[model samples]
Target chain A: MPQGQPAVVPTDGLTTRQRRNRPLLVLHTGEMKGKSTAAFGLALRGWNQGWSIGVFQFVKSAKWKVGEENAFRALGRLHEQTGEGGPVEWHKMGEGWSWSRKQGTEEDHAAAAREGWQEIARRLSAEQHGLYVLDEFTYPLHWGWIDVDEVVTALRERPGHQHVVITGRYAPQALVDAADLVVEMTKVKHPMDAGQKGQKGIEW
Target chain B: MPQGQPAVVPTDGLTTRQRRNRPLLVLHTGEMKGKSTAAFGLALRGWNQGWSIGVFQFVKSAKWKVGEENAFRALGRLHEQTGEGGPVEWHKMGEGWSWSRKQGTEEDHAAAAREGWQEIARRLSAEQHGLYVLDEFTYPLHWGWIDVDEVVTALRERPGHQHVVITGRYAPQALVDAADLVVEMTKVKHPMDAGQKGQKGIEW
Candidate 1:
C-alpha cells in the first residue's frame, strides 16, 4: 500500500471473487538480485495455500544447489508424508532435460530449452499445477533459443487457473506486454560494489 | 551475476575465508512489491544453512497472517523437534510487540517500534542470530520514529557476525548510504494497475 495504485482500472465488470480467482502471469525482470528469489517466495505462498507447485530452472547449473530448492523439496516430502501442504515438482533444464549429465553443445542446450518449454506447455494444458515458477527463464527467450511469440500465445491461451511466474534479467518486451504484473529490480547498491565477494548463504 | 559488480574493490587484503565471514547490511526499498517477500526468502536460505533467524515485522498488521510467516514457523517447529533447519523467532510491532491482541494508540505503536529496534541492536551485539530480517523497517526511519543515524552507527559498530536485511519503501538516504547492499524495486507493471485487488497467497 506504500506505492499508490495506478490510475488504470479494470474495464471488465466482474465480481471481486471472479477477479481474485483469475490466474496471473507475473514477470520479474531487472538488473538487480532477488527476481528468482521473489518467485520462489511466491511459490512458497502458493504451497501454503494447498496449491500444487512446479519449478523449472533454466540457467542455474544443476550442481549449484540453492537453499529455496532444498526447503521446498523438504516441504514437498512433508506434503507426501502428512498432507500438510501442496505437492512440488522440480526440474532442472541445466541437467540436459534428462537423466544424462552431459552438456553436449550449444545446439544441445537450445534443444533442451525448447524441450523444457514443451513440457511446461504440456503441464499448462493439463492443468498439472496451480503455480508454475519458471526460474531464470528470460535467458532462453533473450538468447533466441525459445520463440517469444509462441510462449506468449501459449500463456495467453492456457486453460484452468494456473499462475505462471518467469524471472530473469533482460526480459523481452513481448513478454512484458503479455504479463499481468512485471517488476523491474533496480540496483541502488551492492556489497560486490564494495569489492565483497558473494557468500554461500547470502548469494546462492 | 546479472547486475554487473561494483567497480570498487575492497581495500582490506583479507583472505577469502575471512572476507566471506564478514556480516552484511542489506537494504531493499523502492516503490514496488517483493521487498519484504525477498527478505523472507533470504531468511529461508539462512534457515537452510542451520543459522538462527529473527524476523521483526514493523508495518504490516499483526493480525494479518502472511504465508511466509506460516512456512517459516512450520520450519522452526521442524528445527525444534528434529533439528532439520534453524530456529526462528518472529515478532510483530503492529501488535504492540506482545502476544495479546490489542490495537493501542499511535504513541504505543511508536514505542513498540523503538523497543523492537533496541532488541535487534542487543541481538546484534550479543551475536544472537546469524540472519535478522527487519521487515518493513524503512518506514520507522522515514517517519522519524527511529533515528537513522543511531541505526547506522549501531549497525556499523555492532559486534559479531550478524547479517541484517531492512525492507520497505521510502528508505532514507542515510540508511541507503550506510547499507552494504541496496536494491530499489521499480514497478514496470502491476496487477493493481489493472484495478485488480490484492488477493490471498499472492499479496500477503
Candidate 2:
C-alpha cells in the first residue's frame, strides 16, 4: 500500500486499465460514525469526474437536513448553472419515494423501504447514475425489511459502469460477501465516551 | 448511538447544549482508503454551518490534483461569491508553503512539513478556521519529520471552537489520546485485492 499502490497484483487476464476502470460495489459498515460521510465523500469524487451522483438516504428522517445535502444541492445547482460537474439527485426514504409519502406504522415503514429498494433497482437496470449512494441502507436489510438475496442479485447483475456505495451499521454478511470493497469504521475513541454530546456541523 | 444520541451523559457540569457545541479534534487513521475522504466530508458539514474550512495536504505531491481539492475550491469560490458558506483555504506541502517551492532532497520535504505545522500552529492560535483538515498529516509524525509531542501540545492548548481533523495511517498514540474522536478505517475488502489497479475519479 505504499504510495497508494495495490499490495498484490492478480494474474487476471484483463489489462491493467480495464481492471482499474471496473465499477465497484463499496460497502461501509460498523458501529461508528463516518459510514455515510465516507460514502458522500466518494460521491464528491464521482461528481468531479462528471459522473451522475444519486444519493438515496434510507433511514434518516425526511425533515432532518444533513450538511452534505446542502452542499450537494449547491453542487447540483452549480452543475446546472455552469455545467462544471455532473447532475445530482438526492432522495430520502419516505418523502423522496412517490409511493411512500404518508407516515404510518412499522408495516408502512417496511413497505416504504421495499418500494425504495425497488426504485433503486429500476435505476440500476436503467443505468441512471454513475455513482449511487445508498446511505443508511443497511438498516432496512438488517431489519429484514428487504431481502438481502434480491439486493445482492441486483447489484451483482447491475449493468454499465455504475458504482454503488452502501453505508450503515450491521451490514448483512451476504452484502459484505457480495461487495467488491468493504470498510468497517471502528471507533477507537469518541467525545461521547467522555460524555460530550453531538454538535452541529460535526455530527450532521 | 441510537438516533445519534450520546450513550453516556457526563456529570462534568457543562450544560447539554454547551457540551454539544464544544469543538472537536478528530483523527482518522489505519490502513484504509476513506480516511481523507471522511475528513473532507466532515469539512462539508462544517462548511454548511458557516465554519471556515482549511485543508493542508502533507504527504501528497503538489502536482497531484485530488478531486476534493477541486470540489472544495469550488466551494470556496461559492462562499466568496454568495456568502452562503464559510471561506476555504487549501495548502499543499511544497507549493502551498511560500518557503519551499523548489523540489530538493528529503530534508527539504521534511522542512516543508515542519513549516506547514508551524503555520497551522499560528492559525490555531489565531482561531483561524472552524475546521482544519490536516490531510495525510500523520505521515509527517510517523516519518519523524514533525514532532508528535508538539502537535499534541498545540492541539490541546488551542483556543476557541476551531476543530481539527488529521487523516492518515500510523497515527501516533499521543495524538490519538489527545483526540476527542478517532476512527480507524479497516479494510475488509478492496478491488486491489482482486488485482484491480486504482482508477481516476474513484481512487483520486
Candidate 3:
C-alpha cells in the first residue's frame, strides 16, 4: 500500500434523497399551450390517488374558453371507458373589467369591478373539497379585483394532503412563494403573435 | 264492485306514456326560465333510465347569452356535483346563417351551410356518439340558416336510442311532428314584459 498513488475515499451506504413526494402542481403563463392537458393529467393522478376534487375558474367571459367545459369534453371519453369520474367539481367566476362608453346620463365606466370578492370567499370558505384547481384565478388578483393575501391564507389553511393548482400568466409572487411547487411555462412560440388567431378544438 | 272510475291505473310503476321516449326538449326564448330547469330534470330522468345521450347546440355565436350563461351556471353546480357525462354534447356552429356577409364581394352560402352540416353530421354519426341535445338549435333551421329536411332526416336516421332535444319556439311542423315529446312554455307571466329589467343570477 506504499505506492505513489493516493487512496480513494470510501462511500457510505445511501440513506434517503431519491424518495419523491407527489407534489402540488402549480402552472402559470401561456394560453393555448398544453396547460390544460397537464392539469387534466394531474386530475387523473388525483383521481388515482382517491382524492375528491374541485375546479374553479376566475375572470370569466361570454367566450367559452377552457375551464370546466374543456374538462368535461376531455374527460367525458375517459369517464365512459373507466367507470369513474376522472375530475370532480367545476366552478367558473366572472369579472367586469372593460370600458363601456357613456350613452347619455349614465356613465358606462365598466373599468372597475362591480361584484366584489363575496362569491369567491364563499367558494373558498367551502374548501373542504379536495384537489382544487383554480383556473385563470390569478388575473383578478393581478388587476386588483380580489384580495390575494386573503385567498393565499385560506389556501395555506388547506390540508397538506390536499393538492391545489393555481393557473394563470404572471401569478402573484405571494402565491408562488406559498406554493410547494411552481411551474412557469415560458412561451417558446405562439400562433396569436403572428395573427393566425385561435381555432376551435385546438384553442378552446 | 269497482267504482265508475276507469280501473285504477297501476300507479306502482312507470308506464310507457310517462317515459320520455326520444323526446325533444326545446327552449326558444333567450332566457333561463323554469323551462331550462325542467329540461335538465327530464334529461336526468332519461339518464337514470340508462339511455345513450347526445347533446348538441347550433348557435350563431360561441359567445354566451346572458340567459344561457345563467342557465348553464345554475346547471353547472348540479352538473359538477353529480353529472355522469350523459349523451349530451354542447356545440357551436360558427356564426351567422350565411357566409355572404363575411365573404365580402363574393358569397359562400352553400359552402357555409355545407361546412356547418358536415361538422354537425360528423358528430351525430352512429360511430361517434348518441342522445343529441340540440340546445337552442332550432332557430338556425327556422331562419333558413340550416336545412329543415336535413335536420329531419338526421333525427330519423339517428338510432332509436338517440333521444333528440330541440329547444326553441316556432318550431317547424316537420320538427314538431318528428319529436316524441313537445312541451310549449307559453309566456303566462314575465318580468321583462313589464318595465323591470333583468337582474343578475335570476334572469341571466
Candidate 4:
C-alpha cells in the first residue's frame, strides 16, 4: 500500500474482511458522566466488525470501579469470540500512595502524572486503533491534575481513520475543536433532576 | 455506480480538485442533546475539507424550541451554511397532541410534525453525502412515532459512500444491529443527583 493509503476501497462495497481493518478513535469519559459503559458499548461494536483494539482507563484517584464491571465482561466476550489477547488495559497515574486523594506537596509529583499521560498519548498516537476511548479524561485537566495541551496535540496527530470520542462536561474548547464529534448532554427532563433518588440498576 | 455500491471513493484519494475525500458519517443529535451544534461542528469540518454535502435535522416536535436558545441557534447556523430551504427540514408522522405547562391540545400538529420528520429522512437517504447526521431522532421510535424497521431498511438500501450516526439513549436493538457505530449515554455520577443545578453555558 502507498504511504497513509487507507484501504483503497473503490465504489464497490467492501469485502467482509476489508471492512474489518478500519481504525477508530474513542474517548472514554471521566467524572460523573457515563464514559465507561459507553466505551464498552463501542468496543462490542468494534469486536462485531472483527477489529482488534486496545482499551485504556486512566484513573488517578479511584481504584476498582463497580460500573466498569460490565465493560470488562464484554471485553472477555470479545476475547472469547476472537481468541486475541486481553482487549482492556488499565492505567493508574501513580503508585497507590501517590495516586491517593491527598494533595501533592511539590510540583514533581504533578509533573510525573503529566509525563505518564504523555506516554499514554504517545502510544495511542502511534497505534492505529479500531477504537480508543479516553474514559473520564477531561476532569484532570480542569483540576490541574494533568497536562491538557499535550493530550490535544497528540490527538490531532493521531491516525485520521481512528474515530475518537471525548465525554465530559466543561471540556476545554480546544479539545472540542480537535474532536470530530462532541455530544453535550442536557437535563431537559430527568427523574433524578427532580426529587426522586437514583435506583440501582437504572441509575448506576 | 455499481449495484449496492457505496459512494465512489477515488483510488488516489483525490477528487478532481486534488484534495482528499474521506467518507464521512455525520450524526446531529436533537432532544436537548447537542444535535445541531454537533452537526454544525461537523459541517464546519466538511467545509474545511471542501466537501459537497447535504445536511438535515429529522424530528417532529423540535421545529421551534423556545426554551433552549442555543439549540435554536445551532439550527440557524446549520440552516444558513447549508443554504436555503432548511438546515432543519420539517417532516410529519400522523396525528397527535401534547399537553403542556403553557399550551394545550392542538390538531394536525402531530401529523404536521411527523410529516416534517419524514420529509427530512427521505431527503437525507436519497441524496449522496460524504457525511449525514440524523439529529434528535431516537425517541420517535420509542414513543411509537416512527417505524424503526423502515428507517433501518432505508439506510441500508442507500447507494453511496455514507457514514451515518444516530445519537440517543435506548437505541433499539434493530438499529444497533444495522449500525457500524453505536454509542449509549450512561449517567454515572451527576451533579444533579446531589441536588446541584446545571451550570449555565456548560449545560446548554
Candidate 5:
C-alpha cells in the first residue's frame, strides 16, 4: 500500500480486476530478521479475511514453543469455537515429522524435508488452503534437500485462488524468479551490535 | 537468533543478563511493505510473553478496518476474559485524534500530531507498556510536525524496560542513530509490476 502505484505495468492479456485477484507467490528472503514474522503477519491478514490458513515450519524444533505458534494455535481454536475468522493448521518438521519416524541423521532429515515438500505439493494440487505459509522453506531448497526447479514448477502451476508465501534466507534464484512479490529484509543496525543477547519472547 | 554471536561485544561493564534485559528501540523504514505488519507480529510475540502491548497508528484512517486491528482486539479481549496473553491498547490518529477538535487543515493535523507525540511521551515517562508500537510515526518527524530530537531523547531516557518500535519510510537520521535495531524493507519485486492492484486482506 505504501507504493501507491507500480513503476511499470506489463501488457498482460488479463484485465485489471483479474490481475488484482490473482493469487500471489510472495517470497521473503534476506540475511536479517522479520522474514518469517512478516509472513505470519500476512497469514494473519488472510485469516481475518475468512481464508483457511496453513503454516509449515521447516527449521525450528517442534519442541520449541514459539510465540507465533502459540498465538496461532489459540486462533485456530477460536475459529473452531466461534467461527470468527478462519481455520488454521500448523505443522512443523522438526521432531514431529508425522510422515516418518526416522530422525537423527542428515539423510533422514533430507528425506523428511522431501516428504514435507511432497505433502505441500499435494495440498497445492488439491487447493487445500487459502494461504499456505512455508516458514523457512527456502533452507531445504537452498540445501538441495528439495529440488528448486520442482518447487518452482509446482508453485507456478498451482491451481485455484490459493496464495503461497515462503520465508527464509538464501532463496534460490529460480524460486525468486518465479515469485510475484519478493522482499529482502536488510539490517541497518541490530541490538547485538551493543553486546545484547537474544532474550525470551523477542527472539522466538 | 539468526546471528548467533554479536560481531563485536561492547565493554560497557554491565553484566550479561543486564545487557540482555536492556530495552530496545527498533525502527523499520523503507519503500517496501511489511514495516508495520512485522511490528504487529512482534507485538503478538510480546503479548504471549505477558507484556502489555500498545499500538498507535499515525497514518491509517481510524475508520479503516485493518485485519491486525481486529485480530489484536480479539486477543486483547481474550486476555481480559481468560488472562491468556497480555493486555493490548490500539489507538489511531486518523480522524479519531481526540486531543484536538480541529480538522481539515495541515496546521491542525500538525498540532494533532504534536499532541499525539506528547501523549506518547507522557506514557513513556509513566512506563505504561512493555512494548510500544508507533506505527508510521516517522512521517510526522519527516513532515516536521514532531521534533526528532525530542522523540529520541524521550526514548533514550525512558525508564523501565519498555521496548519502542517505530515504522514508516524516510526515518530521520537522528532517530535511526538512536535506535538499537533498524531494518530497511527492500523490495526485489512486487505484484504491482504485473499490473495487480492492492487487494483486500493482503493490503490492509
Candidate 6:
C-alpha cells in the first residue's frame, strides 16, 4: 500500500492543498543503516524546492566527513552564487556542541546535550529553517543525557511550517508517539555481519 | 553500536582492504517510505566518490520527475563538463524500456522489466557502473514476472566490486537471503494517517 494511508482518515474538511502544506515530523530510527542517508536525501529534496535546510549532527566525531556533507555544502555554495535552490547549513556536534569540546566528564556531556537541545529549541521557536535534520539525535535520549519528554514537547510545540526529521536508533517512545512520520530501519543482514569493514566511499 | 561488526568474522584470511573492496548487494525494503530516497542518497555518495552511477526505474512513470532525478542528472552534466566527479545514467521503465516504444499491456511491462534486468546484468558483467540502483524492482519479482533465483545467482557470482542497491517493498526471500545488506523500513506513523497528501519535492 502507499505510505501513510491508514484505514481511517482523521483529517476532516481539510482541502488536499491544505493537508499537503502542513508541516511534518519525521523520525528515522532503528539498528540498521541508511536512516541518516535517507534524511539527507529528503534535505536534498527540500533544497531543490527552495526550503532552508539545517542539519544538526549529534554523535559523529569531528574528523569524519560523510559524502552528503560535501554534496550539500557544494549545493549550498551553488545556491549562494546563483541565487538558485535553498540555503543549506550543516552543524556537527564536535564543532557546534560543547559536549565534544573537552575531555569531559559524564556530567559535562549531559550538560552539553542539554545545551544542544536548548539551541535546537531556540531555532525551532525562531522558525530558522524549513527542514531541520536532527541527525543521530536519539543517542542523547537513549543515554539519558537529554530528556525525551522535553524533546517531544519542543517538537510538538514548535511554530511555523518547519519540518523536523530525527535519525538514530532506539528512539524514545514518547517522541515516536508525537511524530507525524516514523520509519524503523530493521536489519535483516549487514556486510559487517560477514566480517567486512566500512569502506571509504560506501560507508563514509 | 557501529554497523556490521560480525561476531564470527567469516573473512578470516582476507586483508582489510580486500574485504572492504568486495562488491555489495543491498536491499531497501518494507512498508515505510525512504527506501528509494535512501537508495538515491547512496547514489549521491557514489557520485561524490567519482564512481559511475546508474539508475533503472521499474515502476514510476516517465512524467514523474523526482527531485533526486533532477539533482543527479545535473550532477552528471557537471561531471561531464568539469571531469570533477563520476557520470550518472538514469533510465525509467516508462521511458527507456520497450513499453515506451509501443502501446503496451501487462505482458509488455513484464517484457520491459525482463529487458531492464538483462541490460543491468550485461552492465554488471562489464562492470560499467560502480553503483547500480534498481528502483522499485520488487514489483516485477512479486508479480512473478522476473525470476528471483536467477537474480540471486547472478549477484552472488558477479565479477568486480560494483555495488547494487535494489529498492522496493515486498522483496523476495531469496534476494533478502543473498543480500550483503538488507534493511526493512517499518512504518510507525505517517502524515497520510492524518490525511495529508504528498507535496512536491517532499514526496515526488
lDDT per model vs. reference:
0.84, 0.87, 0.45, 0.43, 0.86, 0.82
TM-score of 4: 0.41
By DockQ: ranked, best first = 5, 2, 1, 6, 4, 3
Error of 3 at B172 (Å): 57
DockQ of candidate 4?
A: 0.02
Highest DockQ: give the candidate number. Answer: 5
DockQ values for all predictions? Answer: 0.66, 0.68, 0.01, 0.02, 0.73, 0.62
- Which is better, 1 or 4, measured by TM-score? 1
lDDT of 3: 0.45
Candidate 4 structure quality by residue, lDDT tens digits, A68-178:
333334344445655542344434443322234345444354565566566567667676454555555666666677757877777777764554545555577666555
Report the poorest 10 consecutive residues by lDDT, candidate 2 chain B.
Answer: B98-107
The lDDT, on a scale of 0 to 1, for candidate 2 is 0.87
Candidate 1, B1-204: lDDT as tens digits: 534553665768986567766899999888888788788888878889999999989977777778888788878877898888789998887757744345545546677788888988888889899999999999988899899999999999988788999999888988888898888888998887776777777887
Best by lDDT: 2
Q: List the lowest-lDDT window of 10 residues for candidate 5 chain A.
A: A98-107
C-alpha lDDT of residue B8 in model 4: 39
Backbone-clash count (model 1): 0
For model 2 the local lDDT of residue A43 reads 87
Q: Pick by TM-score: which candidate is best? A: 5
lDDT tens readout by residue for model 6, A1-204: 375454566647877777778888999998888898899888878888888999888877656778888777777776887766789888777444733365433335566667778888999999999999999899989999898998888898889899999999888899889998899888888888788877766777
Poorly placed runs, candidate 3 (over 4 Å): A1-25, A30-32, A62-83, A95-127, B1-204
Q: Considering only chain A, what is the TM-score of each predicted structure?
A: 0.92, 0.93, 0.64, 0.64, 0.94, 0.90
The TM-score of predicted model 2 comes to: 0.94
Interface RMSD of 1: 1.8
